[model samples]
Target: MNHNVILTCAVTGAGDTTAKSPHVPVTPKQIADDCIAAARAGASVAHIHVRDPETGTISHSVEHFREVMQRVREADVDIVMNITAGGGGDWIPDAADPTRGGPGSDIQTPRQRHEPVGELLPELCTLDCGSLNFGDMVYVNPADWLREHARLVQAAGVKPELECFDLGHVWFARQLQQEGLIDGDPLYQLCLGIPWGAEADTETLLAMRNRLPHDAHWAAFGIGRHQMPMAAQAVLLGGHARVGLEDNLYLEKGVLATNAQLVEKAASLFENLGARVMTPAETRAHLALRDPNTGHVVEKAIETTAGGAA
Candidate 1:
């Protein structure tokens, strides 16, 4: 288990949850502000997904992404930006014609899915490893498309976080690593408790953790009521943890939560476990990331004096 633990806060997801909870940030400004605040609350990274402001639905517009990026850049926070390339894959099959896509289906080509990452060049971007029945609609990402997406991310110099919803997805992620499409030590985000995905329990988490590459930098997250418990489990199992309104909206039973609140809760869990929460600077060093803004290979440099022992 890696002693150092990194916490990520998903600021605003591309989910239709504006009406479900008031804490879900709607506009770009709100999302950016929430991300900055989450950083202050001890989140080293912030996963972002933009939404349509008026309709309060998910959107993949570059303009929306630009707005969020600009605001975060202008702020004094030092959080790592991780944009989503998992959009444009949701496919709702047509009832009348099984072969055709239904109204909510958002099937897009690999290039289309990665346009935002290419344009923005964020420090990290998510790459869902394979297709799965995401609720009623199937989140489609054929192997060819996934390979293309990974190549684009690697070429752009952005680290790809392989998001695995199930054990089979983990196998595919490993396959990608073996194929050399993903460079450096890979990062995995185990998404648990989502309907039709891996369940949120100790046994399931351990099995998935066991299958991961020994050197893989990984994080796990659970949805709704399992959020905090899964965070603690990840920390105990020597892995990083993620929490935000995107996966869980409730702080407690019948209580709505903000992004900041979720991050704070995770921080407390880290404290209880006797593990220190890493800052963005510390996380950057741990991951050995190059600066996205400057193309500099940033490493933690050791300080030495002229004399060994004054």
Candidate 2:
């Protein structure tokens, strides 16, 4: 079992969970406040997704991202911001015409999906590896578009959190690595327990873990009741943990949870599991991530100095 772990809080996802839970943040200020709260509660990173303040629907506006980033950066606590570039890929076919997009179909060019990440320059952002049957709709992420998106993230000096929902997605992520599109030690988020994707069970998690590159920094999360259990499993298997309203909305059976409460629970659970939950600064050093706010290497520059001294 791994003795050290990094806990990431997926603050707010693009899903329609806002109406279900009052704790889910909607406005830019609310989202930024939740990020700070999660960091103070012991989250090493905040995986963020923005929504329209009025409609509570998903949005890809760069200005919205800017406001959220500004609020987080000016806060006293420090945390790595990880935006979602996986929006604008939903495809719900029309009932009458399969060729025409349906009510929920929201598809955009690779550049359109990447506007926020390109403009805001967060330290980390997610790249959904491939398409999947996301419930009633299809999450459309083609290989060529992914290649183009990877190039955009690479050019912007932002590291991507490779989000794989299945074994095939993992294969494609490895392909991206082979094609020299991903930079440095890639960070992988093995997303489990989504419909028609990978199941939330030990056998499947183990299989996905075994398929990952030996050098990759990875984490796994399960939705609903499987959240905490899978997080504990991830730590035991030498990987990090992710927990929050984005994946699960409960502190217990029939009990709603805030983002901070879930992160706090993860921190406590990981500590008792004989694993040390790493801080944000420690996590950056461990992954050799650069400081997005200052444009400095978090650890590699120090390593280079030490090497020269030797």
Candidate 3:
């Protein structure tokens, strides 16, 4: 089992979770505050995805990301901000014409999806390695587009948390490394329990982990009821942990959870498993997170200051 653990809190995902949970952050201010509260509660990193303030829908607005960054900086909390660069790729075929996209379909070019990551310049952003069947819709990420996205993220000096939903995605990620598109030790996020992807279980997570590059740093998370158990499995196998409302909505059987509560629960669980929950500073060092604009390794993990808005 890994003793030193990095706990990442994926705050609000670009999913249809807001309507199900009252605690899901919709506005930029709410998202920012949740990030701060999560950091204060022992999350090493905050995985962020902005939402449309008026409608509580997923958004790829750079300005929204900018506002969240501004608020977090103003709060003086030390959480590694890992933005989501995996949006704008939902495909629901039109009933009238199967060749065309439907009303819920929202596919974008690699450049479109990379817009927020490029502008925000977060230390880390996710790069979904390949496409998969996402519930009723197909999340499309073609090989050419993935290659382009990886190159763009590398050029920006931002570390990519390679999100692998299956074993093949991990293979393609390695191919990217072979093609010299990836920089530094590749970081992987094994996303499990999503509709038609990798199953959320011990064997599945282990199989995925065993295939990762020996030098790579990886984490894994399961959805809904499997969140905590999968986290334990990941940590026990020497990988890190990711937990939050993005993957799970409940703290227990019937209790809905806030982002902070989820982070708190994960931290507590990791500690109880004989692993120390790493601080943001420690996580940066572990991942070698860098500042894209400054061209500097961000080694400073946490700072002591009065708490800001939560």
**TM values, all candidates:** 0.95, 0.96, 0.94
Model 3 segments beyond 4 Å from truth?
A: 291-295, 298-310
List, residue by residue over 141-221, the lDDT tens digit for candidate 3: 999999999989998888999999998998999899889998867788999999899999999998888888777888899
Determine which window of 10 residues in candidate 1 has minimal summed lDDT.
301-310
For 1-310, candidate 2 gives per-residue lDDT tens digits of: 7667779999889899998999999999999999999999989899889999999899888888899999999999999889999999999999999999989889999999899999888888999999999988999999999999999999998899999999899889989999999998878889999998999999998888888886677889999999999999998887888999999999999999999999989888988988877777877787777786668768742121000000
Provide the overall lDDT of each model, using Cα atoms, as 2-decimal numbers: 0.85, 0.89, 0.87
Give the top-scoring candidate (TM-score).
2
Which lDDT tens digits does candidate 1 get at residues 84-174?
9999998887989979988988877889889999999888899999988887778899999999999999998888999999999888999
Model 3: lDDT equals 0.87
Best model number under lDDT = 2
Question: What C-alpha lDDT does candidate 2 achieve relative to the native structure?
Answer: 0.89
Give the residue spans of candidate 1 off by over 4 A.
Answer: 300-310
CA RMSD, predictions in order: 5.7, 4.3, 5.9
